[model samples]
Target: MRTLTSSTTRRRLAPLLVTFSACAVLSGAMTPAAFADDARSHEWYLDAMQADSMWKVSSGQGVTVAVVDSGVDPSAPELQGQLVPGEDLNDGKAGETEDRTGHGTEMAALIAGTGAGGGIQGLAPRAKILPLRYNVKAPSMDTAPRGIRYAVDHGARIINMSFGIELPGEIPGLREAIDYADRKGVLMFASSGNAGDKDNVITAPASMAGVVAVGAVDKSLTVTKWSNHGSELALAAPGDDIPMRCANGEGYCSSGGTSQATALASASAALVWSAHPGWTGNQVLRALIETAGRPTEGKVPSEYVGYGFVRPRMVLLEHQGDPGAANVYPLPNGPASASSSPAPSKAGQAVSSAPQHGEAEAAAGSGNTTLWVLLGLGAAVVVGGVAAFVVRRRSA
Candidate 1:
């Protein structure tokens, strides 16, 4: 998209009064609104994921993310109407909903931008983006598995996929459209590749196997030599140099990779699946990997950063968690089922005990650089030579 990012220390942004609703005001085709005053005052991970008490609870509304890539203009005024109509497995010539390369409109305005116009204010700020539009840059090999089966046949529960391929094999129609969007449950994130300090490559629908991958952290939780790590990652977000809105929202650019951390881990699973709308996408990925953000306690995960950086406010405001079962599969190794075989990983328990009810802006430990981050849903990376959807700039 457009990046240059920076972070060694010295940062602020957490005042957040946030009220919005004269139809979500503030836009003069934003970007550069005096640098920082509103429009999420340059989003420092939304006050380290408190975002005005998780938008009171969850502004993700009904939820409907399906941002394949290479398109999604949605008229840009912080994405008017938040958008709903999608499709363009790369056919409408090129303007598929229209976006060329603001990097899918900066991962769809960082997963539903609602800062109105100064831009960049989305961590599910009333989530709603469904612009499928493939043709990634060139190497389509079938418009990214027909835009992941047209975003799980039109409904789109969740499927971010910022973009990636690395080419080697496993393109069997994107592993049969990721086992048909995991038998239509959806959820699929991606990104887990920025090159992890160059050539630590792994890529594939984010190394396939149900897809979640992600990775990328900075601001101090470390792990950003270039993102991309192994054991198929599974967590981590915040891809440094943050700040977005380029692709025609006029100005404002300072993107990162892991494609804005897979659109903030798909807007933190559309705010814990819009506050548990009956929960299932394997219980909202087992309550965001059991309230993530671990560094140690017993069995943490890490090729770089996994199972530890996506705290959906400790499962939506200290209710803590346990969203297991529901066709189980909490991620741990992969590719091991030939038929209906999904019940084993009841997932972890000691999320260090999980209880931040006192929320002094949470994040009291575990690399507490404002509590790591989330949103690096794979894809959108290409070393060189590409074409049916070619790319290589998540802030290269």
Candidate 2:
């Protein structure tokens, strides 16, 4: 469970606002020399996250995560040795590791970067990074569903989508791809979006079922006012005043959003999963939701932070966590059913019995996180097995 920051009351913004102002957030600007600064020395969240204490337990080794964003610059000094070969959902090529906006690289650094070149260090430095480049919000008019479908078709274990849109009515191809990924045994995470200060609406993919919605939080451990609030939110993480290497491949800079928080949440999941290989995704998620940080009282979740701010160290260091059912998803979907309760998992139990080729091939085609492609469709069901309701619809 990952969470970010937010305000309890809404602030009225001037009409025709160019860019929504955030409370206590860093602007998205990167300076050239800031990249050469000591990356690890600038990671202030580690101290609050107790990362040093958690690292002694698990470094997220043996875990492969798929980053679905603009693109990742493989040549980044700190990320040089950590990135694995991945696909570009945009043009169906293999050379999409080039970071166009630097946001993806920042996310990659947050997840698995080694901090070798004075770049920001990652929470799980030992974990492998699989970059799946896509353009969900591209300036171009062309649209293709194959990017996400292709990633799901590959071998990604965990899919982290840090981009989003607000299109109404579920698009057939996109929904199908999401369903396909779910059946394949993947654990997908997405940003809750940066729209709280405007329409106050949550974005799709984040609003979709089976995707863990992450929000942003600040050093004070309070939710940021700019983060979107809604029933779609699952957890929150540190997103405000966080430092990252410049977006231009330059030096270090600071910025905040559920985007960065989503990466941190994914890193948190990697830590828990790497330590417990046999545990199903449901078990892993159950531990996170159960151990999340509570900023306000009452069992009922807030529209802003959901269950609470995510505290991965609690799950990694504490030995007490019930994985519940192996097949069942603890979180419920649909607008009427927003909250999730602990349930048993049925995810990997039938892997030996299910048809292993077409679905498996689609899963293998997804990307580096084998689990993402392998089990996403299956995990979308009630208990992590193939859903009776899931339909196989192909994309053009």
Best-performing candidate as measured by lDDT: 1
The digit string of per-residue lDDT tens for model 2 on 327-361 reads: 66667662222334432233212222233211221
Number of colliding residue pairs in each model? 28, 69
The CA lDDT at 179 in model 2 is 68
Q: Write model 1 residue lDDT over 342-376, tens digit each, in one string.
A: 32233332333322432211222343122222221
Candidate with best TM-score:
2
lDDT of each: 0.64, 0.61
- Compute the lDDT of residue 174 as modeled in candidate 1: 78
Candidate 1, superposed: residue stretches over 4 Å from native: 1-41, 50-66, 69-92, 95-103, 108-131, 134-185, 188-250, 253-267, 270-280, 286-320, 326-357, 360-396
Lowest summed lDDT window (length 10), candidate 2: 387-396
Candidate RMSDs in Å, in order, are 19.3, 15.2
* Model 2, CA-based lDDT: 0.61
Per-model TM-score versus the true fold: 0.31, 0.74
